[model samples]
Target chain A: MAALCGHGAPIALLSPAYNEAVTIVQSVRSLLSLQYPAFEVIVINDGSKDATLDTLIEAFELKPVSRAYDLAVPCNEIRGVYASPRLPRLVVIDKVNGGKADALNAGINISRAPVLCSMDADSLLEPDSLLRAVRPFVEDPERVIAVGGTVRLANGCRVRDGRVVEIGLGRHPLALFQTVEYLRAFLMARLAWSRMGALTIISGAFGLFRREAVVRAGGYTRGTVGEDMELVVKLHRQMRREKRDYRIAYVPEPVCWTEAPESWRVLGRQRSRWHRGSLETFFRHWAMFLNPRYGRVGLIGFLNIFIVDVLGPVIEVLGYILIPVLWLLGILSVEYLLAFLALSFTFGITISVCSLALEEIQLRRYPKARDLALLTLAAIFENFGYRQINNLWRIRGLWQYLRGSESWGVMTRKGFRAG
Target chain B: MTGGLLGGLWTASLLMAASSVLFMTGLVIARLISEAGRARRRARREALVADMMSAMDGEADAARLKSEVREPRLVARALLELSTLIRGRELAAVTAALTQAGAEPALLRLMRSRNGEDQIAACEALGLFPSDKAAAALKTRLKRRTSMRVRIAAARALLQMGETPDLNDLLAAFDIGEVHAPLELSAILDEIARRATEAYLERLKSSRDAPALRAMMVGVLGRLGRYEALPVLLGAASDPEPSVRAAALSALGALGHPDAEPIIAAALDDPVPEVRAEACDAAGRTALAALAPRLAERLDDDEWLVRFRAASALLRLGEAGRETLDAAAGRASPRAMRTAQMVLAEAAA
Candidate 1:
């Protein structure tokens, strides 16, 4: 927010990139152009095989610097930290290959600020996003560990000058479904949860975190598919255990537009990875389930997570198959099975539509009126195909987990074409 | 013999109906059996939840607790129980379980669902626990959402959280001084919930997001009676966006600002009916006597809401308004008469 310029706290942007020669410059540009005055850009070059390191150095006119490292964060090894020869506020880290998590860690290790931001290489942040995100940390010094900005589907949205000015629906149905899901997910689900004071994950693509809280929780867990969720959970565990006052917040207006999986292959991989991350996080924190000593947060919050989120696909898929099959076999009656299915579908659609209506009542972002109509249709159609396909991917993810497949596969990125 | 034959035909018809009934009953019975199975599965899930809840009184084993109640419904029930615990002032254990459970993407996905009661329940759970996960989800739920239940729960949670970014966002998003945030926010926090403070800070942080944020900043300044934001509010009053300007005026009026009189008076002539209504409210809020004549002009508006709004504004003018309204009422001009009567009653009350 322009109003937040010269105000709020200093924010350090961290982009841990590997082989992202195509989009690192754009990402860095967005950070440098932030509306807030106190922010400095930090880009971690995680041993990219391509000219990712050279590209950033050349573009920003990079120079090396000996930076002291006491940010209270536990992170991967860093090769060296650099600052811009032209723009001193811009910092770069040339780090060994540690993947996204490692690069973020290195950035965290080198950042010199109160609040830290993590951004994906291909993501675009609104100029005001940083101020909007970090304001929580400054206002409530005693509490407030992290804050998440809204993430929008960038596949169809027009991007220019490293910013997304106009938002649009995706061209392909896969991207479209994801777009709707992101809207419903962030706009509905995350908003509702944050209001409830039980936010678990601050997405890695765009979020601000307190350096100490994150470091105390052991920075980003290396080799993890979803360090975002893991870090949040770890933060919750530590903060609540110490009985310290803290919060992970959500900001509605500060948006980050990132590419979604536009094709089936990509969607499948993304969904599977997400599922794996969830499973891994669940497995690690399994002890907190309904345990009162951890108080309401542990027993209730984690318990709900286990039931409503963790094992949702397993029961859902089984239920879908069993009821229909049993009815066809003259075991369970067709009429009854249909009724059950209809009730589930009806309720699901009702909720989705209501969420759509909420969007209309509060933030109507899609430029066209028809977009709302289309989104509503998308909500209805989701139960038929999108939900099922995702369910399939989730179930497959579980199956893979059972087979001890821990490695995350390659994800396609068409990269943000100049919109 | 003819009567007997007729009775036999009726008997046959009754028999056919009885057979159809049997078939239908048979179908229903079979359905019941399957529902029982699903219910049994649910029961198993709930049993695990019950155990987790019971065991959670001591150590937090969210990972284990979730193993028992993996069904969203069961989890919803567990979360409901969890909400009660948090509501009861016991937050630590349940929050841990919530975090542990939320790690499951499906549960997170389901909990994030807009319309599901289970989603609402998860929101409630997060509210009780006051964890990062819950806070994040509830904040996201604030925008472009559907369910009032979800929204209310989210708002209540943030209200409980106090002065956080989410609170700030909510204040920014929903703070029209004339229109409050569902009235639930008023009752949600007695003490300054840390989360509320966080929300307040967040709003201040993102106050540049236009109408919502600008309007909220003015409203908060007006409601909290902050003189510091006066210039900002005045600037906002003449904003290019009518809604933003009106919001600023309305906030100014609420704060009883003398400076907004001309703007409020001018807004009475706005092209938009809503702007006119807001201007009328602003006039009442500001107690701008100069706008009384201008406000009377709206008593003839085609829109009944404007007439009422104008009447209300006029009512603040005391004897002057009573006289104008009486003239309209006496004349039995439909719009003015009805609005005049209601205003007279409201003013008298």
Candidate 2:
């Protein structure tokens, strides 16, 4: 078990907060309760207009501390460093609003830990998340530079004292649909990719990385909305090019419960931004697409992402519109149209159901049968309307990306339901 | 003709859709049944665990305990739980109970199962039994070209069994060709260093081992900080491979032997920047004041990391090193100045 401690690599959990005053306190509290033996929680207040820094300062009893930190990575100016006298492991950095990547860079510079765990301010990690997620690093200390945990929707879960007290299905249709989607993405796709040693993205919600490797990969690249994916790709390229044995792993057990956008508007914005980020990363690392030099990552992982993820929406959206148009124009026979529709919908439902089955076999987090039934229903119902809307949003994202739109869009959060 | 073609396509797609629907329905039913079964098994296991706990309190006989947990899965689970909860004589007692229950044979059979996941579970279960047979089974699995997951599980099982696996087999299994060996080797060596330092030392001295593996071994030795490894590390400092040489230099630093200062200082002039960079770090660790001047010369080196290391090493040398950095900051190259400033700022913080 001592070896499981990653050679006793100290971890720094960095939460870059931006106007998340409502959720920041709970997230920080959740991070503070992590079961890891050696870790420090550093919250970077990215010049939020809201009282995020004030909330953290008041909650943690933080006092300004003069500390010397290496500027290991380039970042925007950090205004001040604060530490809690009561909790020595808790540190907060007040810095200008330099987006997520810049804030992460600042956190990297301020952190002294050998390992860094980047987290979203609105996400609540399970108590043993760090302990479980760090196993890959411990097991493969030389080659495993990064490990990502599964991110589950917290919309339906009951929260108390910054912890998920009760797990349940949200009555919101959008929330339930997103839960199934998250489960499918994390449990099936990410797991299969990681098993093949071609995991491309460790969700920004919760990911652990070696500080040295991240630093050597030039930290998180600034200005990209997909900084997390960009960083993973950069690490893969750098490590592979240097002929170093490395693994970017995804652990399915350690769950990071994150607040999902309940409203269609917010969800649309989030999906569009995510799609744009994927496209940006895809184009940025175009050299790796089908390039055998990068091995499985370039040959399979990159192509899978490019086709199934990046271009999937465009194809689906076009299918939806073009089929109707073609049928109306007499080019597509009504019988053929009906059959095609049936095939697509049923196949989609089957994949979703299969993902649910995989979830049951592996994690089985949702205890109540009623919740599982609701999720199954949601998986089926999502194909009717929710998925189509999501496809359209992603298509819109593609349009925006082509139009050179770099806007992250305003993400309004209602915070988690506390009990 | 077109009508017939369309009809055929329609019929085909309809069949595909219907089959998918049927497949999903079957999966749903299967999942429900499996979940129900698992729940039933879990309830039984819980009852058995409670009985075993009471038995541990002297309420039940060994024969009764074995009968109470007749199922192989239950026995393995109980043993795993008890192993972690109790230690010393209590653990020995639990192991004895498990053996009497024939847990070893059951687990050995499971370890040889065709299913990879089953093999992993069995390997983990075997870890609860501290027997030579269990260790041998795990070692055999490690040598097999099993999935990476199963191999790692077997290796961990062996570690739990307190067996030091052959380092060469471990390296070969990981395929240390062009890339560095998997980091799991580090964990294995960490465990080995604790249990069998002699065996680890012998492997380190074996020239047939991969350079990356030998270098990693040197790192493990350095982390162990065994003064006895100083001679081996000193010999490794001049290895043909620069990576091994760098590893040796870094290990020497970790060992913190001031007597190795000459060897480390010579590495500062090595053709490889990586080796020289490690030498600078080693100099800092050993507080080689004589090398401080030479380290200062690296402050202007072409390699940025080497320059950074040189500056940091100078900082570690205290007042004399501080003088060298101050001089570099004022009169040396731009990179030297930048490095010195950053280190000084860090030092102040």
Q: Give the lowest summed-lDDT range of ten residues in model 2 chain A.
A: A1-10
| CA lDDT of every candidate | 0.67, 0.81
Q: CA RMSD for every model?
A: 28.5, 4.5
- Shift in Å, residue B177, candidate 2: 7.1
Candidate 2, after superposition: displacement of residue A104 in Å?
Answer: 2.2
Task: Report the C-alpha lDDT of model 2 over B36-62, residue by residue, as the tens digit.
Answer: 998988887887777667656655456
Model 1 stretches astray by more than 4 angstroms: A1-6, B1-349
Q: What is candidate 1's CA lDDT for residue B324?
A: 76
Q: What is the TM-score of chain A in candidate 2?
A: 0.96
Report residue B189 deviation for candidate 2 (angstroms): 3.0
**Candidate DockQ scores, in order:** 0.01, 0.19
In Å, residue B73's CA in model 1 sits off its true spot by: 48
Docking class of 1: incorrect
Summarize candidate 1's per-residue lDDT along B1-349 as a digit string, tens digits.
8556555545554454354334434434544565578678777766665655654575556566656445655665565665554534244555455556553344556675654577766665455555566567777876534465566666666555542443444544453342222323333321222224444434444445544334434444545555555666666666665545655665666677777677777778877555677788878867777777777779878654467678878777777766777777677566667667756754553
lDDT of 2 at B92: 63
